[model samples]
Target: MQITGVWLPIITPFKDNKLDYQSYKRLIDHYTEKGISGFIPLGTTGECPVLSDYEFEEMIEKTMEYNKNRLPVYIGVGGNCTSQVIKKIKIAEYYEIKGILSVCPYYNRPNQEGIYQHFKSIAEETPLNIIMYNIPYRTGVNMENETIYRLSEINNIAGLKDCSGNIKQTAELLMNPPKDFSILTGEDLLFFLTLTMGGQGGILSSAHLKTEQFVEVYNKIKENDLEAALKLWKPLYDFIPLLFKEPNPAPVKYCLEKLSLIDSDEVRLPLTEISDQLKDKINSIILK
Candidate 1:
């Protein structure tokens, strides 16, 4: 299935350093009500790297269980280690998740050929659709459009979550991508621009707040109403940068906490809660 529309690469809400599954389920139910196209549960927004193996497994299972086919779920299965990512993919295969949002290898910063071989190996290993995630700042090595196009030639290497932050590259891929390949921008701020240029949709974190507005941005574009879409996107255009002003899910979780959507704005170590000043700013925007 072509992954389309606004998807939440959902934050794994924590309470006193615990998984807070009750809040997680509640969050999922709330998003489901908002009519999101799908759910991405263990992505960067989900804080995947810090989660324990048991927590990871439980997150996937509970996400699928709660979803119960209501919407497609793509579990994040990626790392610098190809073998380990494959192992994670195998584990994901055992469950009922729809696909895997595999990211480019970070830290190691492999060359383009290495990136190609890594995902090619993954495509060979799994029957599931693979959405290659290309976030250069975090991954260190950017996967050029040449490498991306090469990967798209593979049947199961379905599409991309383009976060290269390079408008030219994103536009190039959208211009002449492989048939049936979906390009879903991972940058929440670029959601409108990406869709305007033929992206499928977004895997957005800011979406967790004004859920339907994000969806309607895409819907308005699909209806060829740029005027209407931008009207909906104007406020988001101003607000999205704040969600990342304090390093990702922290600000996102904080907004959820203030909205009473989650129990606490707790996050794993290495990722702290938002600062008091930023919290006050977010409160002003979201509460208004």
Candidate 2:
């Protein structure tokens, strides 16, 4: 499948500590028609680490059910344990998802060779396409472009969620990308930059808001209307950082609640609600 355009690492809606299927369905319905390229459930933005195994599977099931094949779905199936990640991939395969966004091993800080082996093992286990997620800040070990290029040789290692946080590396990869291997940014702020530099698109968390505007920016850029794309991107440029200022999903959930897209903005423990100050600031932005 082509991994392009704005893919939302969708937020899981919770109500009194339970999966809010009603709201989750609403979100799927809401975004499917918003020109979003696809959906990614059970990602970091979905609070993957905190979800129970049952909830994890349930989320995948609900996503497919609600989405109804209206758009592509890429389930986030990742863990530090290569074996465990493979197991999750098996679960995802049971569904009709387009692919899996597997993140790099975290905390273990695996070396490049180890990183390479981790993905290699996964590729061997499945026929499904894999979009390797490389967010060094979270994983604690960067998957260098060399390792990525090497992996691209493996036919099923289809793409990457490029959050390496190194523009030079990103630029180099974009300049000489492997044939049929996509490089979609995971960083929301870098959406336009990635497009300008020849990236496929982004798996953006900030896309949960301003969905059409985000799509328009990608469309404009692809159309080579840089001036028009910049016009759309400039207004969103400053506000993107605030959604992440307090941690993810919290601020995003708050905004969704304000818009009545979801019933509540409650996040699990270890990820509390946004600060009152940030809430007020976001509220003002929404009002404007």
Candidate 3:
């Protein structure tokens, strides 16, 4: 499948401090109606780390049920432990999740070679298409472009989620990538910027609000209407910094909640809910 266009790394909603399945399903329907390209569940915005294995499986199941496979579904399948990720990859294969968003192993801080071997081993275990997620700031190490190129040699290694926020890295990878290897940006703030450098598209958290606007920006640029596209995106530019004011999903969840798309303003532990102060700021900007 060509993994292109505007995708939302959706926030897993919580109600009464539990996985809010109904509310989350409502969101899936909501964004689909709003014209998002695809949905990415259990991603960073989904708070994958905080979710239990059962919750992870349930979230994927619910998301699939809601989307009805109208769009490609790529479930996040990365963790610090390779074996565990492989186990879930097997489960996803059985469950038939469309693709895998295997993030760079977090907290372990593996070296370039280790990261290469780590993904290589996991790819050997599953037959599904794999998209490498490289968020150096969060994973504590950047998956170098060269290492990424090397990994791309492995069959079924589909694409990448480049979140390093370094345009140079993106440019380099785009300059020399394996045949048909897609590159989707993780930074919503850099969505349009990344595309200018020849990125395929983005799996953005911010697309939760500005779905059509972002898509319009992408379409304009794709159709060679740079000026009109930039003008359309100008109003949404400030949203990037504002959405990330605290942490991911927190600010995004707050926005979805404010729009009454989800039932709860709640989040799991370790990632506290956005403060009223930030909420006011988000509201003010949202109003303006």
Candidate 4:
């Protein structure tokens, strides 16, 4: 799976505390029309851990059903435990998922060897292709470039979701990794910078506004149109900070709900909806 292009880590919808199926269908159509490369459910942005297994499975199934093969649907099967993550991977394999986005094990604080061993085991255990997700801030464990280089040698291990804020790590991985290995930046604010620095593309939350912007950036860099590309994307760089003002999916869900894409601004616990003052700021930015 050469995971290239804008992937929205979609928000879960709710109405009267039940999963909002109809609203989800509408969002799928809207995202597809925006030229989204794929949809990732149950990710950090999707509030996946908070949802029950049935909800998780239903969201994945519904996304695939409504997409009707028009856009690829990648499922997030990551957890802190190796065995648990593998179980989820099997489920994705069962669904014939486009790709599996596995985050670096969180809260465990595994050493470099443990991290390598965990991922290596998964890559070899099955014939399924995998995308290595590296977000040290969220996970409390960082898979360095050396370990990543080692993992890159694994045939079935496909690409990486590069979310670590370290530009040096990202740039080095881009410069030295395998020909088929793709480095997709997860940072919405760094979307343009990453492409300019030679990344494949981004899995950006902010791409919701104009999906074409990142795609356009990718095209410009591909065609070597650095000047035109930079000019077009310069305005967006100013808007990203506001989009991430609070915890992720909060601000994003706010945008979607107010824009009438979803039915509610509700997010599960450990994460909450944005405040009214920030909403004013977000609206101000969107208007300008």
Candidate 5:
């Protein structure tokens, strides 16, 4: 499937230290109507690391069930251990998902060759499309454009969630991307810039808030209506940063709860609720 348009790296909701399936299902129903391209659950924005194995499986099952094939779903399956990552992919494969968003191995900080092999191993093992997520700030290792180009040759390797945080590197890849290999930005602020530079779309966390407006921005750009796209984009440009002003999903959950889209704004420990100060700021923005 073509990995294009505004895919939500969807936030997992919690209440009383448990998965809130009610809210989760509600979010799926909500976004499906809002013109999002797809759903990406269990991503960093979904608090993947902190989730228990049962929670992980339940989230995938619920996502598939709740989504009901309304849009494409890509589960986040990645880790330092290749075997474990592959195992997660096996679990996700049971669902009718479009693909997996696998991040470059973290903490161990593997070299370029190792990074290529890591993904190559994954592509070889699964029939599912792989969207390699390269976020140097989080992973501590950037999957350089050279390494990415090498991986792009593999048929099912599919696409990238480009969050390298380097414009030069992003520009180089967009300039001459491989045929049928998508380059979607993971960086929310760069959505407009990336699309302008030939990117397919974005796996945006900030999109959870604006929904239709974000889709309109992508549609506007694709229609070559730059003026209209910018008009929609400028306000989003300002609003996106606040969601990340605190640790992810926290601020996002807060907004969702305030809007009554979800029942509560609870996130797991090590990612507590957003601070009252930050909440004030976000309330002002969203309430406006």
Candidate 6:
């Protein structure tokens, strides 16, 4: 629907290398109390790639059960295979997800036209609203503004998770965005800057720790208090890098565990747990 405000690309917590649905539900309860606007289960923070199909479905099922439509839930449905991605989207539709955050295909490095065709097909295939996720670093192919604008023309292709990391591009898009197109930043570190550039909000992992403070930043900016928003975002200058020091959800999951929101800070393979040194650094700051 209208996807705006701070959404958590929540980590899929693991215990003994198994999906901890109990802990997962508990984490949602915690963030719900924190007043998070929505949840993005199975996103990068959710360790989507490593999860098996069964785990993926079970996770979404659990998330939906707990969420109970309390807040919007955007399922992460992305893959290099257009058919497979659409398959995943259809599966999510079974749960009646509020929306889908489909990433630009990774590894294949599709040409701009290929990117357009891929998302265009998805929009055609589903009645569900889609938020195109453009993280060129991960996908290896940038969805240029023109391509994104073209996709935006499709009625069901709702908005974007702009992780292009190019200020000029983000600013230009914001300057004259499509009607009802929500431009939410996927970059945690750029949340403040993105808002200043007229972004809707962010799908942030750093938000796992200081949830209310992040919300406060958005509220301050919406109230047109840049000074107050900047004050709230200042501390994140140091904290954001640390959350990403190791790799995504690893650092974030570690923080959540420290706060007793999750059972463990464990992550799946290809992504190790956070380093001891970085853990100490995080503990030193948060524990203080």
Q: Please give the lDDT score for candidate 2.
A: 0.94
* Candidate 3, position 4, lDDT: 81
Best-matching candidate per lDDT: 2
lDDT assessment of candidate 1: 0.91
Alpha-carbon shift of residue 200 in model 2 (angstroms) = 0.5
* Model 4 poorest ten-residue lDDT run: 88-97
Residues 1-288, candidate 4, lDDT per residue (tens digit)?
477767888878877778888888998898888766788877878777888877877787888888898887778888888987777777667675777778888898999999899999888776777788999999898999888888888998888888878988887887776778888889887777777777777778787666677677777877889998888788778788887889988888788888888889777788878998999998888744
The lDDT values for all models are 0.91, 0.94, 0.84, 0.81, 0.93, 0.89
Clashes of 4: 0
How close to the true structure is residue 23 of candidate 5, measured as C-alpha lDDT? Answer: 93
Relative to the unseen true structure, what is the C-alpha lDDT of residue 235 in candidate 3, on a scale of 0 to 100?
84
TM-score against native, each model: 0.98, 0.99, 0.96, 0.95, 0.98, 0.97
Instruction: Report the C-alpha lDDT of model 3 over 165-229, residue by residue, as the tens digit.
Output: 68888878877766788888887777778777777898988888878898888888888888998
Q: Give the residue spans of candidate 3 off by over 4 A.
A: none
Which of 4 and 5 is the better model by TM-score?
5
Residue pairs in collision within model 6: none
Model 4 TM-score (2 dp): 0.95
> What is the model-wide C-alpha lDDT for candidate 5?
0.93
The better-scoring model by TM-score among 3 and 5 is: 5
TM-score of structure candidate 2: 0.99
lDDT of 4 at 266: 79
- What digit string (tens of lDDT, one per residue) describes model 1 on residues 150-251? 888899988899999899998888888778899999988889989998889999989998898998888999999999999999998999999889888899
